[model samples]
Target chain A: MIHANDEPAVPMGLPLPNGKLAMWLFLVTEIMFFTALIGSYLIYRNGQPTASQPWPTPHDVHLAEWIGAVNTFVLICSSLTVVLALWSLHVGNSKRAVQYIGVTLALGCVFLVIKAYEYQQKFAHGILPGRVFEKLDSPHGYKYMRHVQEQLEHIEKHGGVNDKAKKACAELLADIRAGKLQPKDVNERVRGTKSIKETNPGKEFITTKDSTYVDLPERSRPKDAPMVEGILEMDTHAHLSYSIPFGNMWASCYFAMTGFHALHVFGGLVVFAIMLVMAWRGRFGPQNAQMVEVTGLYWHFVDIVWIFLFPLLYLV
Target chain B: MSEQHHDHSHGDHSHSHGDHSHGEHSHSHGGDAHGHADDAAAHFRSYIAIFIALCVFTAISFVFNELVRGGIISPMTSATVIMIVAIIKAGCVAYIFMHLKADWGKVYCIMIPVVIMCVMMIIVFLPDGVLGWR
Candidate 1:
């Protein structure tokens, strides 16, 4: 241990212990960094179009809020464990400190694992951002593409949709009118072209010779939806798509903010694991214990940032 | 050696300083093992209390979010309530867990200015159609 008798108590006019002031200053800068990202998210959330009164129907972000809530609890638990680690080390219980830090690190991994799973779900639904954003296979778009995927699968299995598929195709015309369309009322909006009210179970949709029809002018066109001579074709293999109201900008902000936050959690997890090892090796004795305290400050800061981030992104 | 024994209240701190000395072997809080063990138990208790409080607050925020979505509460009011609760939760973590209550001086200078900059950034960087000022 460094000799306490050698070093002066106060290095400057700043009334703080060694490295404490520096750490706080660094955290303050982090506050500014995250503030910029979160502010943009707030603005985007406020400005994004709602599902009500759909004109140019925007992509309503319907993510699994349950996952977000669970992650929040996980982060909170990790924060508690981190503080407990510092407490254990402070009291000269190095073994318990190691235990607590281990828990904190494990919880951090759990949070990331959940985050990765959520990202995978979004990828499957084609929920992407900016230039690569594909509204055609968006969650809403997937709903519209359900029949097409089934028909394609049928064709692959038995060489084309059969009687049931053709019957299903014939019934879908009830929803389509080859002209300009409007919602019946302010509360009413077209989610998809109308199919028959009753189901033809186990039926495959088949496109007949006269099955081609012009698409009714939609509120919005997805990037990948195809049109031939300004007319939407009836082939279920492609063309039909769904879109959110003003989806692109929202996707950009959500991905950027949450993505960066997850990265920070990963970095903290590594740091905590190292510190856990240090504690077990008897390096975090009270005289030189400021490292554990400082890192705890950082982990807590990450937790605090998420405290604000949780409601802002998922709830609000 | 004295500095090594100075962290009397690491987890459940009260910030009561004992005239700090740069001299060797000036004090010893680690001399009392049994007393320290009792104190450790106390500290863990407080940690448990704080964790429970944080969890309850989190649940409340989730409930409020659902209420806002269901239109049981006005959106603006719900937002206000959630932010206020978030601030409180952050306070507990910063003070109790991070031990910021034991700190002052340079931290305040750094913190106060950064907070001001945060508010300014929000106003300046707000995106289009938020206030229709665009």
Candidate 2:
């Protein structure tokens, strides 16, 4: 190996040293951290963008946006504090530099506090995507109620539940209970309705003209069943066709990306705090102020990441 | 170099000054050392400007984000718009606050690597999107 003085080593860039390089490397890792999140988001969103019912009804995502936006502002301000601190050190005021850095650190903490509040709200709303998935199917047996309401409204405007339809439905229920006419025994009975309740294996079969009238298990049946007479169609139909599973890829990505990024913001705050104390000690005057600048770079980077994350998570 | 090497106690009042010429150096005009108080005072104003800008940017982001998250606008579109604004805000902090604009050109070597790492991070996380990997 060549001797230290003899080696043909040259300064890199303008040549401060390895400090800037270290900062850069650290930033790279942070990028990876967010990438994992955004990537996951893309994957999950692709699979199920319109999973929520009513076809894009705005849910509680609005709540998250408020907190996220405020946090973003907090971070951006902190970023300025870092720069100002560095500026103070530049023209030569270690005391002011320290003060600015301290402010920046404090701001970081404020952002985190707001973030905690937002998370709490999410927990309260039972908004967990996974949990919501469990209730997605068939509107939880209230389809007929919705249907009857629509029909009732129609009759109010026109007259009433057509007498013919009521008579037909009542007769159908009576026939099944009486067993005087096998529901199946009447060929015309099993014509139009869609079956909601599953048929019990051991139960007796009541054949109605409408094939859709399969008797529900007693436990599953609603207490106040709307009079099942006529087909009460609503103007607005439930698009039960595309109820995608919740707790899928997007939810997972959203949590991971935002979670990891927030952790970095935390890390940045700690570093800034240490820098502040050092500055107070006059340890970061004009010459050694590089430390503050470096840390500030980190703080700014964190802010930038959040700017991207906020919109991606809340806006989308 | 000497300032970094020496461990001066809190009481060391004689401003340590040696070996500064060895590297691309910056002189620390401690509050007591500086003769030009006016210049020092001006730095404070710059700090305020940065602070104000930061606050305004954040406020705008908050309002915009609220509208978007409220489902007034779609999240995807809002994300893209916010990202552009965020990038601008970050640049201000980096160049002005962090003083990358004033430092040695060589400092960019450090910056470039950091950017590359960030890109790698995004690529690494991309698979999670496709596979449902957390």
Candidate 3:
């Protein structure tokens, strides 16, 4: 009969405990899963034509690098806490272990909150996949033109413009409906107004019912003042058009990669919560300290994934 | 023989009890008590050092990206430096924080095949997908 003093039996020729080995196996599969996602992202990113549809940088898309950096720091700190929790368990300090796990869980929550905020910013700017625009001739451009028309109608209803200006707006709306004037035309008109404003410091361009004129003294009119006034006569009220070249593909890759990663973080938080409860119950010690170590392995893998993701998504 | 028997008794006692104190067990194990304490201290110190290193690496990557944005450096240079730094940071976390260094033999056995598989995936996909090859 096997006695209490007998050496513990090795399972499947592995020195590690069954649970620890199993966790490592699970992590290996997870690594492969993430690798596949990142690989697809790179393929799509590299396959695009730079001349026709240049990939949008994070700055171009208004994604702040500092936010991603801060989140990376947070995850690194959580990794430390998780390892420290396992260390505390090994030393028989279950209280410290529980505290460390609690901190790690809280840090995970902070990361997700920041990520959600970034997503909210993207949604507010209409940067979602399939809805991004690079030119004013596409479907999204027409939609934006309609939006501008609505805003102009709202302004006219509120007596925001003179009768002549209101009539000009009505004609502009008719041209927009007939597809006679594109957003590019409006954009060029707005650009012209800005240039005129820059060149003539004291003069103000006023849009009247019939024509646009410069509010300048008769004796002080520059030689180019009439030409500037004529240029500014075109409707420039629809200056809301913007472009994000290849933003649809960029959004697709960004959301898929980071979204999966955030989901993994959430999964880690759930496991950490369970570990915290176990620590509170005094379930960890040298006798079963391997349990904490196994859990820490999973948490560290999640951190390592983010370590790669932070650079790939934000920096590059 | 007698010492081994005593150690077994302690192990069995801890296993049978609901509130086993690992610190007390190590304390009762003579020279192992001091060795375990020293090892634990070293591990704790290493964790702190790694945490600082990770923070510094993250800062370096951020700065490199800023340089690229300012047009002081090329995007390729920034990408290369950032990816290298990321690899180093990941290595630190995996080796130290994950205890892969302590159990290198066993864990490497599990990791090597996965590494090869990941490499194969990249090799097969990069050429066809990235370079526009059939």
Q: What is candidate 1's lDDT per residue for A216-259, written digit by digit as tens?
A: 22323343544222111233222222344444565677678788
In candidate 1 chain A, what residue range of length 10 has the lowest lDDT sum?
Answer: A195-204
Model 2 compared with the native: what TM-score? 0.57
Q: Each model: TM-score of chain B?
A: 0.64, 0.58, 0.76
The 10-residue segment of model 2 chain A with minimum total lDDT is A234-243
Whole-model lDDT, model 3? 0.70
Candidate number with greatest TM-score: 3
Which residues of candidate 2, in runs, are more than 4 Å off?
A1-9, A12-14, A51-58, A128-135, A138-251, A276-288, B1-80, B102-134
Q: Candidate 1 at A91: error in angstroms?
A: 0.9
lDDT of 1 at A61: 48
| Candidate 3 lDDT, A115-158, residue by residue in tens | 99999888865678886655556565567577657655665567
**Candidates arranged by TM-score, highest first:** 3, 1, 2
Write down the C-alpha DockQ for each prediction. Answer: 0.35, 0.20, 0.33
lDDT of 1 by residue, B41-116 (tens): 7667767888899999989988887775555777567779889999999998887787655454336777888889
Which stretches of candidate 3 lie above 4 Å from their native place? A1-11, A134-140, A147-180, A185-241, A279-288, B1-27, B128-134
